[model samples]
Target: MFDRHKSTPAFTRFTYFTFTYFTHFVRSAMTAFTLIILTFIIASIFHGLTGIGVTLIATTALASSYPMSHVLVLTVIPCLLINLVVFLDGGRIVYYLKKYWLLVLTSFVGSFIGTKLVFIIASHHLLIALGLLIVGYVAMQFVAMSVGKNFKLPNTTPSLVISGTIAGVLGGATNAMSPLLVMYLLSATEYTDDPKTELIKASNLCYVVGKIAQLIVL
Candidate 1:
């Protein structure tokens, strides 16, 4: 008869939740699952129709409802998967891989370094920075295309090499590097209006190269 009805610890009481706790957990999980599906649908539509990067569409759509950090991680899976699907189905992978060898090698090297840096920095700011960069790059490209005026900003070799490096590094960090990559590809060619297509091509080639290198090194 020492303690037939001893009181439970507050922590224990909380851990041994009643029916209400599980109900709430299930409800929250269902809500999150629905939101994820919605975001994926919107992102897929945007990418398929306009060839815009999936990360851009997915991040913006999920930003309001989901934590930015979570969205960023989820974004990478779809982006990479979509690319893999396109590569396997379209038959362009082999051709482009051989064509843009330098861009591919440079991106891998830069991305490897960038990935390490990302682990050291805070997560919240990463997505915001990437979003802003995308918006800004798109705006600039639109303006250039409208004017249809050739502005000799810099030579292609140095600019491509530098931008590819930066894109790989930033892409590795935030998974939103497509905007920067697109910007670099646009700068390489005179026609800014057609950057989305060109950027997609460049990215495909770079990804193939980077993956091969990663396989070997890692």
Candidate 2:
């Protein structure tokens, strides 16, 4: 009677198991939380030093442990804010928009479609594809440097639309469009007056729209 009133054997064992599970859960949560904090801190530092890496770094780091969809959702807001700061601070917005409105619109469409595909396709396949894409980009860059080839991007309307659409799809799927954007901008023969500013303005415009689409979709 006294044992029953105090605690039955089954109840005591269950209580112990629950406590142990809760403790493990808290520890795991804290560890993940700390890792996220450090990752973003480093990502932001790199972004400040260079003009890129906020979303790329954060997404790559977090996606290693989390689901791609969750990683995308987590980084969207921060990426949006960062892109907005770069874009708004760059100024000459009207001229840039006038020159690149088609690119921007195409990017929006591509990003929306790509983001929607995140739900349609299995994320692990996308993750593997993303890995391959990054590797391919790096390899291409290395080859270009080895061959001393300056890739000249065609400034035709088709090229502009195609580049923007591709960049947007990649950005929506992986959130690492900075490299393509940089490559696209650097290859341009025009915009030599203030290439850095123009590049930042153009890339961030696409980034802003892409993030907005992500927000809308997810």
Candidate 3:
């Protein structure tokens, strides 16, 4: 007995609701995109001044808008992947394997120990304190150009072992270890007035490997 020509109001209302939902979703996505761009710009400014600043800067920015634990978890894998790519593509791996196999091996062993330590630490404040101290010391060194004069490094096997072990311990305590690693390397070398290009490259290699190993262990 119903009229065959009658339009169904339910179908028309559903179509209108779906369209409205999609429109709102698109607007929200655009807003998020804008926010991320702003964060990247701020991070980039830090990176320009110091190579190690980007991660901290970006992490801070993300933490401002997201949960700290969530941001830390999200950043780990991508940072690891990026370091892997740079280590491989930049010939750093080949350089270390060819010229500094022992350094690489010792660092690997140390990194394993460090990774275990990270699990033992209940609070993250120690790591933050260490990171701040490292950055501060480096900044002071940069301000005083003559500070590295007469820096003599231990150049024996036993010394290398001890250095690696201590570096490993610090690395375990903090997510960062490059500052300690570099200082140890410099102390062992008599690099005054000589081109230290190779030494610089080797230090970078250590950092790359240490970071990658941390990523794996953590």
Candidate 4:
């Protein structure tokens, strides 16, 4: 006459914890899916008008509910796909690769190292760092736009290498590198006349390389 209905205390605790974890996972997944859909549409519109904002929009949307590292990882595929589409549409992939090979190579190296760092860092610290990076990028953009065409950043070898490295690290950490990339390109005197097409092409190429490196590291 064993008690068939009674469960052991350890078994009860295990069941409770398992169910709680499953419930939280399901809720987070659902919320992430919904936010991604909404943000994709909005980001697409902005990306169409300007050659940026897709990753920023997606990362910002997911950052509140999920860890920043998770958001960066999840956005990598989508960002890569979108950049591929844009790169193909422009029909200048070969030209960009040939022209900016050095910059691209350095960026890839930086991104590989940065991606490794993401895993080593704590989740809370990553979130705070990402927040500050986003804020700094926005402020930099505002000031640059306010200053208009007067500002200039020479595209020397050192400048390109430094900017590319910074862009790669930021891209790896938060998946938001367009602000820095765009600013760097815009500041160049050659690109100052009419930068839209060149800017889009260059940024897409850089993003494609960075995303590929991130996927490899991940």
Candidate 5:
């Protein structure tokens, strides 16, 4: 008599393969999700301390694997909320707005324009641009530290306009403007009693504005 259970059916092998594939897929997906969350947490902590790292950290860290467009989308909300919290944490909203109204206006315009370009550009190009932006910022920081930056810009209309527009465009395009704004505020407030506060306030203000621009365009 032929043994009825002697041989495995093809369906058994197919079912085994499917189950293995599904299990592996689920595990891999969970791992990726966890790592992404971990990256965001680290970035958030750094931003809380420095008032600038969320975008810089997230953008550079995730850009290699994820499309820059998706990374920016992930970044836009958290960055906005963090900046709002930080900016409000210090208070004096009236003072900051009054002082930086022009800066805010110019940044809004530049950010809006820059954000519009994001949709038109290719994802790979945007990724490359973001990578270069981070690298350039790091290089500039190195130069500033090693060579000792001494020149100071007066916080005049011209300086504020230029800085605000550039920072806004940079923030809008790459979602990392802290490097430029940090350098700018440090240079401009050589005589302020509380330079650190000024930096937090100014940078957060610009960041908030740039985020608003991004949100509007998006």
Candidate 6:
């Protein structure tokens, strides 16, 4: 099925270039796969410790190959599955929901609005917004770490609403709202004593609720 032909200089050059391009593509794809695996491992560890970071880490890793919008969608199933595991593991879902119903409801509404906006807004603008939100989340986390457990927002309706809304918007836009929810939970007075446990519980709940809202809206 093969025919032999004399190779010209141009043909030689084309063959070399094609091989080089193929090699590079293979290497790049392998590198991305390896990084994604590593990111998943690290994110899982962080999730176990803090009930957050899986979406953020996975998004950061996969953004190399996909658009932010696609990354957000790709993360939904994984986030929902992981959050469900965490939420069930933590147990007492009813108690947390009853205690933080306002936050949950506000977050759901905010997420609903955010999901709608994601469809309306330009992709580049959404990418810009996602980048800013991630940076802000990192800064807030740093501040919380430096300030310690004593630094807390009042556990009032307004605070909960604001935090939940912000979390919902970010979550809806990027699927990376766990950090904000964790921050809000950690800073709330209700979780002051055993913040780690409460943080995991509330953060997982928020993530589950946010992911569900995104699923419905998207």
The CA lDDT of each predicted structure is: 0.63, 0.81, 0.56, 0.77, 0.79, 0.76
Stretches of candidate 4 off by over 4 Å are 1-28, 150-152, 189-194
Model 2, 80-159: lDDT tens per residue? 99878877884788987887788789888878888988888888987887787778778888888999984556777777
- Once fitted onto the true fold, the runs of candidate 2 whose alpha carbons sit more than 4 angstroms away are 1-6, 147-152
Residues 109-172, candidate 4: write the lDDT tens digits.
7777778778888877877777887888777768867987433456888888888888888778
RMSD of each: 4.6, 2.1, 6.4, 3.6, 3.5, 3.9
Across residues 28-117, which tens digit of lDDT does each residue of candidate 3 receive? 889866776676667556544443434445555565555434444444554444434444544645755676566666776786676666
**Error in Å for residue 99 of model 3:** 3.0
Off by over 4 Å in 5: 1-21, 150-154
How many steric clashes between backbone atoms does each model show? 0, 0, 2, 0, 0, 0
Top candidate on lDDT is: 2
Which candidate number maximizes TM-score? 2
Listed in order, each prediction's TM-score against the native is 0.73, 0.90, 0.56, 0.82, 0.84, 0.76
Residue lDDT tens for model 5, 1-218: 76556555766887999999999999998987887788889988998888767777877777777776677787789878988988899589998888778878888887887787778888788777777878887787787789897334456778878877877887787776766567667766567778778778877888898889998988
Candidate 3 off by > 4 Å: 1-95, 128-132, 139-152, 187-195
Superposition error at 95 for model 6 (Å): 1.2
Predicted candidate 6 versus true structure: per-residue lDDT over 1-218, tens digit per residue: 43346556668899999999999999998987787678777878888786667887787777757776677677788778887898788467788888778888888887877777778888778777777878876787688678774345556677778889987987787766765666567567363667677777777777788888988986
Candidate 2: 10-residue stretch with minimal lDDT = 182-191
Q: Please report the TM-score between candidate 4 and the true structure.
A: 0.82
Candidates ranked, most accurate by lDDT first: 2, 5, 4, 6, 1, 3
Tens-place lDDT digits, model 1, residues 1-218: 55535645654677778557998999999998888888788877876766555656666677656555465456655666666654555466665666566777788887676656555676667757767776876677788789985233353778768877887776665555566666566555446455555556666555544434333333
lDDT measured at residue 70 in model 6 versus the true structure, 0 to 100 = 76
